[model samples]
Target: MIKSRRKLWLFVGLFFSVIILLTLLVAPSRNQLMSGSTFGVAPDGYAAWYEFMQERNAPIERWQKSFKTLQQNYSDNSITLLRVYGKSAQFAVSKTEREWVKKGNTLVNLAFQGRVTEAPFSTSHETDFGAVKIETTRRNTDSFKAILKDDFGAIIWQEKQSEGKIIYVTTPYLAANAYKLSPGNYDFLANLLESSGGNKILVDEYIHGYKDKETQEIEETSNVFAYLLNTTLLIILIQGLVIVLILIFVYNNTLEKKKI
Candidate 1:
């Protein structure tokens, strides 16, 4: 009995161990990836492109192709990322953009990008100097917002409010790494001021957003083993009664034989 109980417990432990290993491998990451963080060099292609083309000197089509990589990372249902290559003026030339007209300088949105509604850019919703001027606080993991898109990190887009020029940036990597050489890169940093007059950059020392993985508790099953344990315990309690009844029967049989 002791050996059997020990074996049962050993099997149970082994089964539980296997389940734990499988759960970890199958589960998605809790908060593994970080954005706006630098790689070995520049953070993204857009920043690199801006760095190259800022002086009209480091022009390369191959270099521009890297920026396209950023658009492919977006989820199709929630976000729609549109990239326009070459000079920014060519954006107005498309037939679909006929409804859109330049107001002083900013490109007015005439059509919707297939969302719930055909929403255009609203000045009412627009902030003083943030990601975009949209009123709703939706989860946009693209280069639109001042916050870094949390998918393995990507391009950094900047809108200069004073100049009314939106810079699709890729220059921060140089600024971040070996900043002493190109100290001027950060001289005109993108302004991400909140409507309440506070800095929006959330650079915390500890793992701020990295929360612990939510593990589901396994429900214990009252199976054959549990039933056996109950039966065994009941047997131990009534064991004396069973022994006494057997002895009484043997004693009665012996007395009858003696009388015969």
Candidate 2:
């Protein structure tokens, strides 16, 4: 009787394990939870713009690694779009990134909330993009040029640094999915990028929690479990082994019961 009960319990466990595995395989993805990511479909995401650029055959790429890695294989006259929120340490521009920009690359820094470290310098100048007019608050400076403005003052400013330039747009909304409602925003961004004379355009996805396999490997060098978890084939093999083991147990229990 004890043996029969044990067999029943094993069978039950096996059946539930199979069900759980199947459920996991068919479960809905949680990519939507990742805001601002190119894979995300959220309103704040750049998926739409990314797709649009791909469709246009534009020389654009999603940068899924760190700026330090980017520097190792740096391309001259490239444009990098970096979206910034507040002045948090997580999003703070590193010294390496600054150096990368100095090497004849353009950095399009977008700050939607308009809260960031003060620009190197700026000027009281009015610049308009189609029907959208932008104004600068600070006194006129030779190096800083205002590109867009609103009642809140200069929403976009450009500053030259060494061989490259940094264009600060006080609003990330200009390139977000919301731009679909306003065609002018799309035109303004397109023109701005084109005018930058960058040979390639790179959207920084590393800041949005997307990292390449090489990056994951570097971060998880000492973690065997993490390495196994990241291997799809190994995971599938492990699941298959669990099912096979359950089958063998059930078969052995059935023969033992028959003998009894």
Name the top lDDT candidate: 2
Q: RMSD for each model, in Å, please? A: 21.8, 9.7
Clash-forming residue pairs, model 1:
46-169, 46-170, 47-169, 47-170, 47-171, 48-170
Give Cα distance to truth, residue 254, candidate 2, Å. Answer: 45
lDDT by residue for model 2 (87-200), tens? 221244567767777878888876543444344333233235444322223322334677765334456778777887888775444556755565555557766776787887
Candidate 1 error regions (>4 Å): 26-201, 204-260
Alpha carbon lDDT at 52, candidate 1: 31
TM-score for each model: 0.24, 0.59
Evaluate model 2: give its lDDT: 0.63
lDDT of every model, 2 decimals: 0.30, 0.63
